[model samples]
Target: MRDYLIAFLTTGAITFVLSWIVWKVAIRYRLHPEIRERDVHKTPTPRLGGIAMFFGLVAFFLISTQLPGFAIVWEQPIRMWALLAAAALMVVVGVADDLWDLDWMIKLGAQFAAAWIVVGIGGIQILFLPFGSQVVVSSWLSISLSILAIVIVMNAVNFIDGLDGLVAGVCLIANAVFFAYSALLARDFDNSPETNTAVFITVVLLGVCAGFLPFNWNPAKMFMGDAGALLLGLMMASSAIVVTGNLPPQLLADNDQFGRSQLIGAYIPMILPIVVVLLPLLDFGLAVIRRTAKGRSPFSPDRQHMHHRMLDMGHTDRNAVFVFYAWTAVVSLSVLLMYIGTTAGWPGLYLPGLAYLLIGGVACVLVTLPPSRRAARVASDTKASS
Candidate 1:
């Protein structure tokens, strides 16, 4: 307990100081993002905040390793090194894009290449299928799946960075859930092999974002730009893959001694990554669907994002951010409840998971309702204008 507390506080303080230092540097350099087409804010904001976040993550990992009980995660450290390398690649690509307006193709190519390096050279692949299922993929398939996951998550985080605090806030929530799940797995579930790595990465990620949020929130002082968003996305996705693929088989054996079905009783927390990250995934899905429907490039910038829709409906920047924050909280709490309820035998495990999906589905509708009405009024006004 004391170790965990120290880890959290040490990481948090390191992140804050690093972020503040980077914030000052950005101000000095005038490295700001412009209000371009499809932009959500009116004022230019510093775009290299990710630089601070990167340093913060590095600082946390270093600090954690020095503490007792955390040395192993840094020892060998292939996974950590791989993730850091991938993150650095993305951050460089992102920062370049921010400064010089790199085309989407180049940006995407950079992301894919970085992901490939991680999975191929670093050997971080998704070896498992669904939780507790023996249906594992071949090494080739695992590498392919890992690449696809990385790409999807990279874009999801990048796209969701449209509004102030959105990306940082969402990452914080998701990592928190993941950290708790990993900690529980480590403490209760026989201190599984995958526990330390999962906890370490996610804790570092949470610390980075914790340091970032104060500068990112509404009427923001600094933007994370593509560097931060892409780096964060990759880290989150990589951690999820690691947690789900490695933990279950070791901890939740398909034996009769436990008496509980590993399929049902275990793997409940497997849904944490998905549920906690529902908003970005949903928004990314909608963005693709809407853009494709309009005969436009999916990568093209547009004002059809969830936050944009909220703003179009007259929600303030802070309101739009908070509304999404509320939804994120709802999904997180629902997952926690489901975890507890399933353990207590309140209902089947899938029920709570399904309940979470249903709630997110419903919230999606409620949030868009105001925007729908606003759209009607906009059309009516345009007709009058013509």
Candidate 2:
């Protein structure tokens, strides 16, 4: 726990400092592209924030190796190196796209290549079924599913990087939730190196996002661009793969059919990582479908994202971002509570679940409320004077 806190703070501080440096460099180099019609921000902002985040990730891993509790990660050099290599590849691709617009095919190919590096080289493949009695999968199927999962998560996060602080905030919450769960698994149930690595990855992710959020929030000083978005997506997907793929086989066995059935019925944690980002996935799928139905390429850029819709429905920039954040928190925490219920029984479920529901419900209502009545009254009075 102490090591985790140290890792988080160290990584966050490094990323925060690096973010400022990157911002200045981007401005000096005139690295930002001209604002497009579909853009939400009026002013052009410096990008390449991902460069800072990538460095932060590297720094965290290095620092972790020196920490007594985290040093065990160093034993698995291949896995660590593979993740870094894939992240570097994505960063390069993202930086290129930010500097000079690349063709869609080139970006897509790069994503696939990075996925292959993680799954094939790092050996982080999804090998279990979250549902059904069956758990283990064939090697070919595991590899294929792992790649597909990585691609989906990568693109989902990239697609939702529409608002200032939106992606960063969402990723921070999602990673923190997963980190908590991973830490629990490692500390109590599974003290394996694999679980510890997952915790480390999540900590790194949480730190980078925390460090970057200040600059990326509303009235942004800089944008993360594709570089930050893709890198974040990759890290999140990698953590999920590492945790899920490395689970002890006994956890997934059907030795006691009734007990297994009961556990499976409530054990949403197995898929909690994916569920936490379901909003982005849903938005991405809808965008593709909406574009294809209009006889346009699925990748065609547009202003019809969930955030865009919020703006269209009269949400201010900050309000829209916060609304999305609240929804994500609700979904993530709800799933987390369900997982606790699965392991700790009904009493564990009711209190936290109800509290989350009440708080989340109120937050959603408040965020979704129309423009203030006070403001409306002032507008009417001004109209009358006119």
TM-score of each: 0.86, 0.91
* lDDT by residue (tens digit), candidate 2, 26-145: 889888998888899998898789999999999888777777888776777788989999999999999999888898889989999999999999989887765554378789999999
Per-residue lDDT, model 2, residue 340, is 58
In order, the Cα lDDT scores of the candidates are 0.76, 0.84
Clashing pairs in 1: none
Clashing pairs in 2: none
Estimate, for each residue in 62-173, the C-alpha lDDT of model 1 and write its tens digit: 6666676787566557777887888888988888998888998899899899899778876667776654444578888899988988889889888889888989988888
Q: Could you tell me the TM-score of candidate 1?
A: 0.86
Worst 10-residue lDDT window, candidate 1: 250-259
